[model samples]
Target: MSVDEIIEYLRTLPKGTVVRVLVMDKASGHLWSSIVENVVDGDVWCREDVGTLIEDKDKKPTPENIDRVLAAVPGGLSAFGDWLTQEGWDILRDIYDDAIDALR
Candidate 1:
């Protein structure tokens, strides 16, 4: 999806839901990583870092990184449900779905 769509989806989240994007860095002959974080912040917060993927000067996670975390995070479906219940965060489930598709 487009950035605006992603941002909009993020905006609709209830509150205080820990949302993050992760990316890989192929620097120093090894692969490192960083995270682009966006908590509810009463709405949404977005910061896309460049050079994080190709270098480390200004690091930020990539969409692929987010996909990896999502794959590893146990109870992926329940995580959102839990967010809704525990943090009262409104999750835009479709956003995640679209994210996965975009990465694929």
Candidate 2:
């Protein structure tokens, strides 16, 4: 799929809404969890540890001061799908996964 297709896919989910998603590695059958932060432009931001979404300083997942995604690799949307293209991974929605799947 093209980057736009992936971007379009990201656009389907509403911003600020907690969701359970999965990125499956086709080679090892390994699964990784992620939080899709901004849908417009930016690395596919995600707080790997959902518990830390609202850091000690913040008590809410407001995206401004709460969502603390790292500044390094996993930070942009294009980089996301582009990396996705490189990794041969697939993204799926699992509504009943776990609390950590949520953005909040």
Candidate 3:
């Protein structure tokens, strides 16, 4: 799905969903509860509470931080999707499936 569609779907979720959210800077990470707001240009817009851990360092979220956050979430779904866009579905799927199975 397009980022806009994905964001729209996220916006429709119920409150308190245990979404694996992360906010970070070049050097640190924080986790939070999140929902999607909208997409602007080519980037996905996420609506999330600033995670206390991530915010304690006084850092603002950045694209690189978003990438790092996505990469570390479980099911590896978001990372897999993003990687599939750049590296092809087959490769990331193989990697993701393997990671998922290993976790079980």
Candidate 4:
């Protein structure tokens, strides 16, 4: 699906609906899952446990801080969809299915 389609679909969801995405660390080749907590103004706000392992005096991971923003535009959504594993795609499909069922 196109990014616009994905964004429009996401907008149909209620606030606080959670979506999961996998984040990869380039330096360590490690991967972790992050949660998309909310969608606002065409951006998906996320929180991840990425920066927790490092000891940084200047910065820290907190709930108030957003880990990343996934743009609702075509490029952004396309990249996100491309990054997903088959299982991740299945999860997203399930969410879409559930939304459709709820609307019926």
Candidate 5:
């Protein structure tokens, strides 16, 4: 669905309703990976997953691995203290529009 569709659908849900949002880094690639993240700012959060994947084990690619990450996902936000951007902030600003304004 489009961004507008997602926003409209979310608004229909009751307050405090549980929802899962997955942001994947790779669009097309081999089957892979686990996600480990920290910082819990609100009721919405993911489970703790410090475990390793069998395919990812012993496959720690350096240098090039870092380059691959920088290329694929260029925008990010860290909500620990405040809202910020890496790049293409306008994309989010336009997509979220005023819905994110009340978040401030």
Candidate 6:
């Protein structure tokens, strides 16, 4: 999906939905995960958990870092499949499939 498609899909979700996403640091090949606590006006607000790669390493993982990592990812949100765990992917897939089916 394109960025616009992702934004549109997110808009369809209920507020305060918990959605996990993988974030990668292009320079270090380091990866982290965040849980999106809410989506507002095409912007996703995430919670950086203690187990996040950067956070676990005692590094300060700021909101800017999350945004930068997301921006650096190729193919935008569509590329999330490469990083999501099976359970995470399944959750997202179910949501996407349900949303698509609802339109029929």
lDDT of each: 0.51, 0.50, 0.53, 0.52, 0.46, 0.60
lDDT of 2 by residue, 1-104 (tens): 76579778878977766554557555643455444545332233344343265555466644444234433437555675587656542332343355447647
- Give a tens-digit lDDT track for model 5, residues 43-86: 32211111122125654445455345434533521342133232
Clashing pairs in 2: 42-76, 42-77, 43-75, 43-76, 43-77, 44-76
lDDT of 4: 0.52
Give per-model TM-scores: 0.26, 0.25, 0.23, 0.23, 0.28, 0.30
Across residues 6-35, which tens digit of lDDT does each residue of candidate 3 receive?
679878989866444334332443333343
Cα deviation at 98, candidate 5, in Å, is 47
Question: lDDT by residue for model 6 over 1-104, one digit each (tens)?
Answer: 56588779978989767766556666644555444545432222233432265577776777676667667768875675455546565877886887877894
Better of 3 and 5 by lDDT: 3
- Candidate with the larger TM-score of 2 and 5: 5
Report the lDDT of model 6 for residue 68.
70
Q: What is the alpha-carbon lDDT of model 5 when measured against the actual structure?
A: 0.46
lDDT of 3 at 8: 90
CA displacement after TM-score superposition, residue 40 of candidate 5 (Å) = 7.2
Best by lDDT: 6
Model 3: colliding residue pairs? none
What are the per-residue Cα lDDT tens digits for candidate 4 across 8-103?
987998887786554656564455445454533222323343344222534655433323322333567566546555656587787688787789
What would you estimate as the lDDT of candidate 1? 0.51
Which pairs clash in the backbone of model 6?
none
* Cα lDDT of model 1 by residue, 76-99, tens digit: 746855665655423455446678
Ten-residue segment with the worst summed lDDT in candidate 5? Answer: 45-54
- CA lDDT, candidate 5, residue 14: 93
Off by over 4 Å in 1: 1-59, 89-104
Clashes of 5: 0
Which stretches of candidate 4 lie above 4 Å from their native place?
Answer: 22-35, 38-104
Once fitted onto the true fold, the runs of candidate 2 whose alpha carbons sit more than 4 angstroms away are 1-4, 36-104
